[model samples]
Target: MEILRLDSFSFRYPHTQRCALKDITLSADEGDFVLLCGASGSGKSTLLENLKPELRRNGERTGEITCLGRPLQSLSRMESACDIGFVMQNLEAQLVADTVRGELCFGLESLGFPPEVIRRRVAEMASYFGLGKLLNRSVNTLSGGEKQLVSLASVLSLSPKLLLLDEPASQLDPVAARELFSMLARINSELGITILLAEHHTEELFTLCSKAVLLHNGQVSFCGAPREAARFITQNRTLSSDAIPPQTKESGSAYVFTSLLPSAAKIFPDEPSLPLSVREGRALFKQKISGRTPPAPMPVIPPTAPPAVSVTDVYFGYGSKDTLLFHDLSLTLYEGELSAVMGANGSGKSTLLKLLCGLLKPKRGTIELFGKRGAKPTLGYLPQNPRLLFLADTVQQDLTACAENLRLLHPEERIQSLSEALGISDILSSHPYDISAGELQRAALAKVLLSSPRLLLLDEPTKALDPFAKSKLAALLRGLVQSGVTVLFASHDTEFCASYCDRCALLFDGQTAATGAPAQFFGGNVFYSTAAARIAAGFSYDSVTCGEVRNLWIK
Candidate 1:
């Protein structure tokens, strides 16, 4: 049975000149796992919102939309809200309740579900998604990943017939992300839920989704199998995969772990498709090494200068709760380094970053920058959300303002060089929000580049990029490394960490479990690589980049 159908559906913003979704015709049958992918602003959100008609405003709409046999346009707000569960792109904005329990129960209470029923459902969902422990926790206290998961659980508790998810796992760590997807798959398989997820991470999504739809510029460019859409996007690099009909790549076999890479342990998988992520690669490698000989890798640390970034005797937390985010934690980052901090939700990976970037003061101990310790630890910082830009009316104005700010202090630089390099030269005059997320990320990068800092601290940098955009970022990071910049990035993309990073640090229980190369860290231990890496299966002299792995073949 077709759970929902859209026929010749078209819509535009209020009084807008152009259509936001033009001739958008698509359908999702009952119990189908559908992946809706497109570039930023490629009608993905528009279409998802249209799935629940009550969300749409006074926009010009035509054609027929039926949801569970009801006319979509005529459905009441309450009915539609109950029928469709939406987990939006910006989780922060959608969150309404003050506490975790309140947020989860708010909707159920409104629907007049028995308080006992709501409580029971809330408990089930909380435990199911690991939120049971944080029931009384304040919503704002949760990290990006926790908030997202909580929001998702809140929606899923409704048992919606159609679930609309826009990058639900975008801000989680690799372990958390894998767990989320695993849960999603389990729910889809068990609950007869129809899921339409718009995402940027294709590697894992491809394995999970049964069908794929690529949208570009408010139109459906292609709708088919995951492999077909992957090929289409790969071949076409000129257009954003989600926005325009993408050209599939002819020969590149890279996955997109833009900011991460794993170790090249001497364990290889005897499988069909080699893994492209650390977790997947390591799993396969583990299988191969089992009942067989394990190859030893040479210790990667060199007998040279001291570690690049070192934290000693650090104790930190917020208010007086004694959260003890980091308890006397000490670590070292060697020179010419690309290191990552990995942990589950609320493990203080980000808090540690804030201390390193000089944004927060440590409750105890000291942090060293390149060889010195102080309040002014010179480092470049890119927050998870790039919301620091001044409210300039136009994109050109934003750039000019950024350049001007950098100029007033340094007075010895040029904008054309960095702007061109970052590919933001063309869109220098558009509104910041009007631009795509990828472009906004790039522009933010360019702005940070202007400061010419020696060290870079990035928090979940690949939140919303598709595979191609992610790969481009990985290449750019590699370039920065070659240019002698050190990076301390936090990412949920395990492949990114396993492939590009020289070392991996796993933060757990207010302390780091291990800190070493990807191979050493992921090999023969509780720590794991990504699914792509596992699928790649087996060890090569070098593991492929976390984002991409090509077969060692000429075909």
Candidate 2:
């Protein structure tokens, strides 16, 4: 049964000239799992907002919406609120309480549930969501994954029939994202809850979703079964192709996607039953490449580039000596190199960036730039949440604000040139919050580049960007490196590092555990490796990307 529907819906936000969503028609059946796919600014978030009446934007609308066999307008506010649950892209924005138990009870309390009922529901939710251990813990202390889980569990406590997720895993690491998706899959299967999930990462989701709707510039480009949608996306590269699997793109003749890429390397488009897991992929690999002898792994030579930033015997922390994060940790970042710093949450990766940026002073250590002592070179730093840097109402205003503080290389033309360079000139008048995360990222980057820094530092720079945006960012960083700027970013995106970074360093236990080329870094580890590396194992060393593996296999 159709639980909700939209017909020829169009919307334009206040103070905006362009429509955010246009002639969008879609539906979600009871117990259906719909995957919403799109580029950064393709109207996925706007569509999800329209489904929940309370969260709808203040805009001009022209269309009809029906919910549970009734006109959406005819439903009461309470009815609309109780039937649909919306989870925003920013995890912290949705959290309202101090503790896990308090968060779970906040909604129930607001709904006027008795203390007894609220208590019963909170206990049930805590146990079911595996948040029992964290019930008494402060919500602020939890990791990105934990916070998202609490947000979902808190929303589910109300027993809403429909769940709307907006890039729920955008801020999490790969392992955390996998776990969240697995839980969502279980929720769809066991509880029969209808789900409409908007996401940029679709590799693991393709196997779990029943239907998919691809949005392009606020219009439905493709709406069909998940597998068919994969085929459609493969043929139409312009339609947010970042969500397309790496293994699928590696197929030279035809686009192919199998959850088990190790076993099924590649398959023809005509192959109907694509393997959906590692086991299935392995079985398929045995059937195809049974007796072929695999190639030997290559050795990685250490980089000999001149040092750009050098750290020596650094001992630093926030509060006291006992709280030291980096103790005698020494490392050197090379000039004209794109280096990635990676580690688990709370492993001091971000602290390292702060130390390099001069935001945090080391208690006992010396940092040198270009072999010069006590010299502070021009630098740009983008924190984990770049949005925090936004201070003005509009993108242009924010850029202008940044211009006032910049040590401009070109003093005559200020924000205009930088805005154009970042491709945000078109949305200069729009509010920063109104833009997509990817656009905001570019805007933030433009603001940072105002000073023309010789060195750049980014923390989780790709947290909310899709693959297409990531490619653009990678290219942009590469251009900066070519221009003699040293680039270093802290990230959990292993695939991106393997594909783009010149070097990768694993930060752990107050020191650099390993530092080497992408091939050597990923090829040495099993669990902390990229999907392409795992799939191409035994095929060739130094093959961290699907394209590289494909070329080697073809040879």
Best by lDDT: 2
Question: On a 0 to 1 TM-score scale, where does candidate 2 land against the true structure?
Answer: 0.90
The lDDT of each candidate is 0.69, 0.77
Model 2 global lDDT (CA atoms, 0 to 1)? 0.77
lDDT, candidate 2, 1-555, per-residue tens: 998899999999998788889999989899999998876777889888888888887999999988888998888867766677888898879999999888999888888888998889899888888999999998987888899999999888888889999999887777788899999999998988899999876757877889988776788877888767756545533212122343333343122222112222232222356544445543554455556777666666766888988889988876666887788888888998999998876778888898888888888989887787677798889988878889899988877767776645554376776665566777888888888887888888878877878989998888767665677678788988999899999998887899899988887788888988998899887766776566556654576665554444344
The count of backbone overlaps in candidate 2 is 3
What is the Cα root-mean-square deviation between model 2 and the actual structure?
4.2
Candidates' TM-scores? 0.80, 0.90
lDDT of 1 by residue, 1-555 (tens): 998888888988664577878898888899889987766556777788778765565678888889888788677777777779998877887789999999999889988899899989999999888887888999999877788888888998887888998777777766666677778888899888999988775556666777888776678877776655555444433322112222343422222211111122112222344343456555654554455432334466652646678899898888875567788888888776778888877888778888998789888998988788884544788887775754787666665676687665543344676666655676666667655666677777766766777788888777676655555577777778778888888776766676668788888887777887776665533325654344444543333332232332201
